[model samples]
Target: MTDTPTSRATLDQVGASVTGFFQDLGCELLEYSPDRAVVALTLAPRHLNNAGNLHGGVTATLMDVAMGLCGTWTEQPEQRRVAITLSMNVNFSAPAAADSRVRAVARCRSGGHKTFMASCDLLDESDRLIAFGEGVFQRGALRSELP
Candidate 1:
């Protein structure tokens, strides 16, 4: 990442890019800001697990995306962040049915020169908490290069 006036522009560009990327995945942004972000996705049959409930991987992915994006919203253009999922502890509280509108809310807890930490929760349409996660990510290089 290169910090410059142009970097600020790139940051804005990333916001749009992130939105587009999720939209393509059938997720919609309901709220977004530097400290928090919320996204929703309608559970489909394709997202089901072997037992018929929403898959654990799907829930984890949604939480991760939301948390990472929350960090992105606060980052300077020249300073990119990569979500490493260094540690994610997820608690599944309920089973989510197909066609349910699932919402993921992510909040950044702390961030600094080289790392960021965040938490996220996944809720069903009725606002029932289905799962929650806390994650740590290393920031600076692009995600592809982060280890």
Candidate 2:
């Protein structure tokens, strides 16, 4: 990530280099700030189900990841935080075809020092809604604080 002029710009600098489960799912971080996050996934064969559409589990995972990231983002890298999903509800509206790209946009709706609520929308390439989710998350130990 390059040295950006603003926190939001800095967040946007991180592109498809997300690690762990995000990397495994081929997720690209498009934009992230205090209360919002946008992540795109490159759909593949493994992402589909028996009916040849995006699996509900995959959609739920994407939603959880987006909401968790949205709720836990911080300006200070060293202060990087984590959010554990307390509860989540996913509403599947449309089907996403294999090999098609989908983007999940998430927003933190409300929060305290220890917990937060967030919502996410999964959209196809044409911006059709694939799924919508809402979740409550609890703040967890920071990455730096992890043993």
Candidate achieving the largest TM-score: 2
Clashing pairs in 1: none
- Candidate 1: tens digits of C-alpha lDDT, residues 1-147: 223223434434444455433545577666656767787889888888989898888888788878887776534433445455577778899999888999999998998866789999999988899999898876545542211
Go through the candidates in order and give each one's C-alpha lDDT: 0.73, 0.81
TM-scores of the models, in the order given: 0.74, 0.85
Off by over 4 Å in 2: 1-19, 145-147
Task: Name the candidate that leads on lDDT.
Answer: 2
Using alpha carbons, what is the TM-score of model 1?
0.74
Model 1 CA deviation exceeding 4 Å by range: 1-16, 19-24, 74-82, 141-147
Predicted structure 2: clash tally: 0
Give the 10-residue window scoring lowest on summed lDDT in candidate 2. 1-10
Model 1 CA lDDT for position 94: 97
